[model samples]
Target: MQFELQKALPVLERTPQVVESLLYGLPDEWIHNNEGGDTWTPFEIVAHLIHGEKTDWIPRAQVILGEGNKEFVPFDMKGHIKEGKGKTLSQLLDEFKILRKENLAQLQALGPTEEMLDLTGIHPSLGTVTLRHLLASWVVHDLTHIHQLSRVMAKQYSEAVGPWKQFMGVLGGKR
Candidate 1:
């Protein structure tokens, strides 16, 4: 378990970078793809991530830091995506970037203590998870959507006819 946690930290550290890479150079139209009427575009995903960071993640982190037994609620990603419907891709990405940086700062400030690893709140889906698990999941969530955004970008590029399309194929890997 210790070895696994150590390995996961580097992935957590890469969340911001993953987000930047995932949303970089996305087209404006692609940001508002209400095509299927049931899917989130790249812009919506960024906004949802920002909302998660601000509402779900930070409060839980504070609770884990010995503040109180505050109940951590799950974020409403669908609602956030809807609320951010008209925002530009750049605007959403910038907000997500700022929120992610703040999360990283808070995580960095934790002392190396077992108390830091305590499981405080029970996630409705994930059940009881430690601070360490929550921290790790934060990055995993970022990475998961990073891949999703890249796929959206790739599909958009594939529909285009240019050298940029060829470049997109190489850039958008599932890794």
Candidate 2:
């Protein structure tokens, strides 16, 4: 799809709400509770999402908006997790919400399409990328993680034991 800020803005704006709903009232321990395998806990997912925004999305947006170097360095995901370790879920979500808002403002005030294309960033892995493409991928990235969160939540609810499982089954396997 030809992704643009106007096209992706709604999804971007709504993502925080979706994430908020998914995380509401979830026990702190639930963040650490993996799905009986190597699957990441909800907490790790949230942390990763926030990290993606800070390290990937925001910097890329800046590059696309002609505010940063064309040859940007890649961010380390593991380092992000360690740094975010002390933060609570609410704190991380709040930071993400603020960053999202800021990104929206930058997107709204973005210059002409030509100017956007003039900008670039070396993705460390992907090499040089046009600003437009990077912004487009940011939205795609959000949708990917949203779907992942949905799947994880589904697995958690479905595998829930005892009365919770019975109740969730009654609620169409969602709770």
Candidate 3:
């Protein structure tokens, strides 16, 4: 599918509100609640989102637009551990909101054209990615993490949910 900034910009803009509505004012215990195994807590997920806002989407778009076929830097998925340390949930959310707004403005200012969407950049892993792919992935990435945060939070009540686990997909379903 073609990359549609008109569709994507709204989703990107609303991400902070969506996250805040889901997580704001929750107790530390609930925010820090994990699903066990290697899963992340809601706090960790927001932290990771903040990290992405700082480093991922706009930086990569710049590479695709400015340096066609040049190698792009790999994003550190686990960088949140050090980057997010000593930060409260509110700080992370506020930072993400500001960063996302700035990034979106930067993207719009670029005035992307149809040809620009076909521009290529070399991913450190996937290799030879298009601008369309990068932009689409950015939108999808936000949605993926939102769903992930919901699932992680829902699973905190796994035991309390009792027999409803079969009916409650978020508790046991694959993401």
lDDT of model 2 at position 102? 79
lDDT-superior candidate, 1 or 2 = 2
Model 3 stretches with alpha carbons more than 4 Å out: 173-175
lDDT of 1: 0.67
Off by over 4 Å in 1: 1-10, 34-37, 67-70, 82-86, 157-175
lDDT by residue (tens digit), candidate 2, 1-175: 7656677779888888788888867886555676567677667777787777667776666665655456665777675476468888888778778878877776676643756655777878888788777777777778887777766666655645555764554335555
lDDT tens per residue, model 3, 1-175: 6669798889989998999898989999789988898888888898888888778888888988884447788889898786579999989888888888998999999988889989888899898889889999989999999999888888878888787787888976442
| Per-prediction TM-score to the true structure, in the order listed | 0.72, 0.77, 0.94
Model 2 residue runs over 4 Å out of place are: 36-38, 64-69, 112-115, 157-175
Instruction: Give model 3 RMSD, 1 decimal.
Output: 1.9
For all candidates in order, the CA lDDT equals: 0.67, 0.71, 0.86
**Rank by TM-score (best first):** 3, 2, 1
The backbone clash count of each candidate, in order, is 0, 0, 0
Best candidate, TM-score-wise? 3
Q: Rank the candidates by lDDT, best first.
A: 3, 2, 1
